[model samples]
Target chain A: MFEVRIHSRGGQGGVTAARLLALAAVRDGKYATAFPFYGAERRGAPVVSFVRIDDAPIRISSQIKKPDLVIVLDPSVMDVVDVLQGLKPGGRVLLNARERRDMKGYPTFTVDLTGIALREKLEVAGSPILNTPVLGALAKMGIVTMESAKSAITEMFSDPRNVSAAEAAYRELVA
Target chain B: MLTVATGNKAVAAAVKEAAPAVVAAYPITPQTEIVEQIAEYVSSGELKSQYIPVESEHSAMAACIGASVTGARTFTATSSHGLHYMHEMVNWAAGARLPIVMANVNRALGPGWNIWAEHTDAFQERDSGWLQVYVGSVQEAFDAVLMAFCIAEDERVLLPVMVNLDGFLLSHTMQPLEIEKAGDFIPPLHLPHAIDPQNPCGYGTLTGPDDYFRLRWDIERSMRDAVDVIRGTQERFARRFGRKYGMVDEYRCDDAEVVIVAAGTLGREAEVAVDLLRDEGTRAGSMRIRWFRPFPRLDLSGRDVVVIDRDYSFGFGGVLAKSIAATEGARPFSVIAGLGGQEVTYEDIAGFVRNRQPGRELWFGVNGDV
Candidate 1:
């Protein structure tokens, strides 16, 4: 089973990204489950969402304690929360950051997801929605293909620019 | 066709397939998506039903009862405080012999305000005369909701059925669900005691001690009879859909000396713990009690039974442990765990098995005394 944990603030589409990832995996003929750790239901609160993908049925319903990959949608969240708390050894980090930061362990991929969202004009009420672009970065990990991710984004969001944002992030992802 | 869906969406899809005559809508966290989807179905003409927008959860159940009395197949969904708000009507729906089906997303009832998965909300309604079935998976949530209507509408069991799923655990968690058309298995609902305008008879009228006692007995008799009706319904569903469910789902229980008994998602996790224990040569098994209402008879005769409950009864103990001990007459190693959606991993359950002792209630992961 491949478990991925996504960290972001509320109203930033963290849960949407998790669901899109699961839907993409399902579209690709694999079993997947996505759910959010619902804390305070207000905007700007730190939120976490999880996705589990596997060949067989995923049975365990507990939160992802040891995630195979961690996707951080908001770079500022790193100061407040431990985004890499339960990352397994040799696991990868997909960060929506401006610059690549060297970590002792694990392969880290940094993408300017906010910049990409701004460039693509993917903003809701002036705040850049970075989850879609972060999902594109997540696709680079090979857990879900870029094509499947784009299709899922299109299926979930009616706006055409969201697909463009995902595609752009998929191309602009850097390690 | 198989599709990826959260438990809430699966339930809404199942309800749509059932195509109830009326659906009362009141939004609550983890449960809101269900009624939201149902409302969408109703609005889009996918499901031809009357969607009653109620102000509160209490009114939701009240509306269900009102619609159900006219012999309409009714459905509703609620969670946590919402379930508590509908507490009075919950009992009324059952006592009135209305075949109402409700999806209850089990959540923690709070003074501190929590919306996480917990069984306390559902467990509080144990005596309300509702046939309760706690489901573990998104698929089971859909299947149980479909089967609930059949069981409740049966002449032998004209009681409301509460399909309980863990809030945000099974409720919000997505999975691949294989949904069968409800018309294939469930026939049109037939309420024997429905109010007919032509008959001009009174319903739920005041009864003296003599008549009231018999009415209560009748409900009890029907509740007991519901056990067989539920099994038969599930058997027919299996034949049609090729998926079978039981009142109690046993996993690796045969030839095992130690067993962990649980309900909902905890039981699913315990199965993983059982496999891990067996790998280390410990004879362990997991028993998932599906139907909490009928409380299926379990054989823990020679096995060291461990009861893991997500809800407690304050003064007594874990609700499941008490129920099991009442029926099986064996003092189980009771572990109260996962209240307010506290994370309980399979490894935590394995630790419970390793240090289990009989005749004591151990609150798993509790910091200090009691």
Candidate 2:
């Protein structure tokens, strides 16, 4: 089984990214589940969402304490929350940042998701929606194919720009 | 075919398949999406029903009861404070013996204001004469809601059924759910004591000592008879859908010595814990009590039982553990966990089994000792 924990601010589409990832995995013929953990309904607050994928039915319902992968949609969340708290050894961290920073002991991948969102003009009320682009960079990890990710994004947003943004980030992802 | 959907969406899908005559909608967190989807189905002409957007939960249920009395198949959904707000109507819906089905997203009630998953919201209405079924999976949530209508509308058990699922845990969690079309498996609802204007009948008027006692006894008798109705309905549902569910789902319990008892999503976690314990060479199992209203008698004759409850009953022990102790004649080690949606992992569950004091109440993951 593969588990992922996503960190981002509310209204930034972290929950949507988790759902899209699960959808893509399921479309790829794998069992998947996704959910978010949030108390307040306000925007700009820290939000956490999770995704689990496996070949067989996933039975455990608890939150992902030890995630095989962690995706940070907003770098500012790093200061407020421990996004790497339960990251397993050999697990990878995908960040939506302009420049890569040292993540202590884990391998990190970087993508300018905000820049990609801006390039693709994916914004809602003046905030760049970075979920799709970050998911695109996550697709580089090979857990889900880029084509499946694009299909899932299209299934959710039904917009050509979302598919384009995901394709752009999938090509420009850097380690 | 299997499609991925949230638990709330699965419930809305099942309700749409049931094709109720009326749906009373009031929005609440985690539960809001269920009714919102139902409203969309009505607006899109996917489901033909009278959709009433009420002001509050009380009015939502009140409208369902009103519609149900006219022999209409009715449905509603609520959570946490919303369910508490509908306390009076909840009792009235059952006391009037209306065959109404409601989806209750179990959430923590608070002075501190929490909206996480907890069972206190539904446990408070235990004596309100409603048949409560707590579901663990998104698929089960859909199946249980479909079965609830059949059980409640039976001639022998004309009481309301509250289908409870953990808020956000099962409510918002996505899973591969197989939705069956409500065909001959669930027949049209026929209320034997409906308020018929053509027959000129009086309904729910004041009852004196001469008749009130007998009415209450009748409700109890129906509750007792509901156990068999639920089993038979589930059996018929399985025969049609090819998926069988029990009043209590047992996992790896055949040759085990230590068993963990849980409800809702915690039961799924306990099943994982049982596997982990077995890998470590400990004989452990998990039992998920699905129907809490007509509490099924479990055979825990020779097993060390550990009860994990998400809600506490203040003076008494864990509600499920106490019920088991009263019925099964065995004192269990009670553990109160997952209150207000505090994270309880399978590792913590295995630890509970290794460090349990029989016949004692242990509050797991609390700050201070009790």
What is model 2's native contact fraction?
A: 0.71
State TM-scores per candidate: 0.95, 0.95
Model 2 chain B: ten consecutive residues of lowest lDDT: B361-370
Residue range with the least summed lDDT across 10 consecutive positions in model 1 chain B: B361-370
The residue-level lDDT of candidate 2 at B218 comes to 90
Residue-wise lDDT of candidate 2 within B280-333, one digit each (tens)? 999999999999998888879999999999998998778999999999998898
- Best of the candidates, lDDT: 2
User: Which runs in model 1 stand beyond 4 Å of their true positions?
Assistant: B198-204, B367-370
Q: How many backbone clashes does candidate 1 have?
A: 0
